[model samples]
Target: MSTDFTDARLLDALGTLASTAGAAIMAHYGGASSIKSDGSPVTAADHAAEQVILAGLAGLLPEVPVLAEEAAAAGRWPASTRMLVAVDPLDGTREFISQNGEFTVNIGLIADGRPVAGVVFAPALSRLWLGAGSKAEAMELPPGAPISAATRRRTIRTRPLPAGGPVALVSRSHPDAATSAYYAGRGIGEQRPVGSSLKYTLIAEGEADVSARFASITEWDIAAAHAVLAAAGGEMTQPDGAPLVYGRAERQFRTDHFIACSGAYAAAGRR
Candidate 1:
């Protein structure tokens, strides 16, 4: 569990851990759910997946502290904060409860207030994405599949905005007026609604072009996918074009409104 491991090695470890956590979540996909004090839905799957991920992370990088959604909701915070792992065991619990295959398990490595490496695993979709540094990759793996060097993966990168316009992605469950207005004002007519952090990955893989969110979101919700997007030649920033960063303990790991887009779109002054 040396922290000196390379980003590629770290991504592989996280990919395996995320896939395992996804299986834990799938075990109770349709089970009962309850409301947390914050009014957000929580199910056994969330806890189960968190347990698996936390344990895996402990083994993978013992020195790095972990900040996870379920644990934080339960008032559990890691002691050390120099560098940490952000974990969202089940990112789209509503989607999971609704039996849609749009939820995901996210794990991101944070350093210097930015996500440097991370993994996003959608077990139901049999899709996985991971990135560290300039290398971002996506692959297919079943819910219970094990990851190794032999795992087949393809390099993924963001595509330049089309000559016509950039396709926009919005939250499938939390559409707001401000976001709609932002896109409409940009003359972005083609929009696709997606759940969870998948919107970031879509843009990362060149499947889409941009995502603008005026609504505030949590760190664990976007950190892993943010890393993937950055590594894939995309950028996430505030509406004023400031870099989106993580590990904001003062804000309880919450983030301000942000926009994510491909490098070309960003360079084109779309934000």
Candidate 2:
């Protein structure tokens, strides 16, 4: 298959699914009556969005396997030897349930344990970010604007994390107590919270220098962001100071603890 096909066609398909699902989510925002899943709230929007993503992916890339969040948790890990796609039909379920608007539709093309292309669309916020290979780039989309980037545009790059007072991005919902304590006990900088894998952009664009997470994350959630961050002069690695890699054959497919950083944070994993 042509890599270019994955670049434009796949990304476009993902953007559409995300946007459509986001609309479904917004329509159900703040409705009463509760049915929670795995201790987290589950709204009609979640299933609707997942179904849309799943159906679209199946139609677009009929050959490649799909590992979607909702399905994966329910024992639907794709079994493709060649390549497969990982989809977070909706990331940040809490944010979506809370109507806080940080949720996103994440889709990544994973081949031989690496992300070839990733599309993250926050429909409610009208932002679209896609990254390919080792180079990830992020862009914002005006609400109701065409998804194509031929019109308005901006680029992203990593700025060094402040020294002695480093700026950090922590999880908005699933905070890692150990990671937080590690930074605070080390007497480092201030921490900011955001939803999903959006923290990758902070270090990528120089807004924040370091983002550490010891809590569980899936490969689909970080693969595309990893590419973008790596391309923007940053690194994503395990807390043990190893570069992040994929294709592990775990049933759960949990990602190890990692830190994304510009300059100063590049070495934090070493300690």
| Cα-based lDDT for every prediction | 0.88, 0.69
Model 1 lDDT per residue over 1-271, tens place = 5675235776787788888888898889789999999999999999999999888877889888899999999898877656888899999888889988899999988887888888999989989999888988999888767776325689999997787789999888889999998998786849998999999998999999999999889899998999999999999999999888788887888998999999988998888
Which regions of candidate 1 fall more than 4 Å away from where they truly are? Answer: 149-152
- List pairs with backbone clashes in candidate 2: 136-228, 157-204, 159-206
Model 1: per-residue Cα lDDT at residue 195:
90
Q: What lDDT tens digits, residue by residue, belong to model 2 across residues 1-271?
A: 3445246656665666666666666666676535555576566766777887777777777888777777866776877734767777667778876778777777777777766677777767777666664455566664334467323345666775465567878889887679878777654567888887677755776788878887767887887566667667777887767766675656366678887777556655323
Total clashing pairs for each candidate: 0, 3
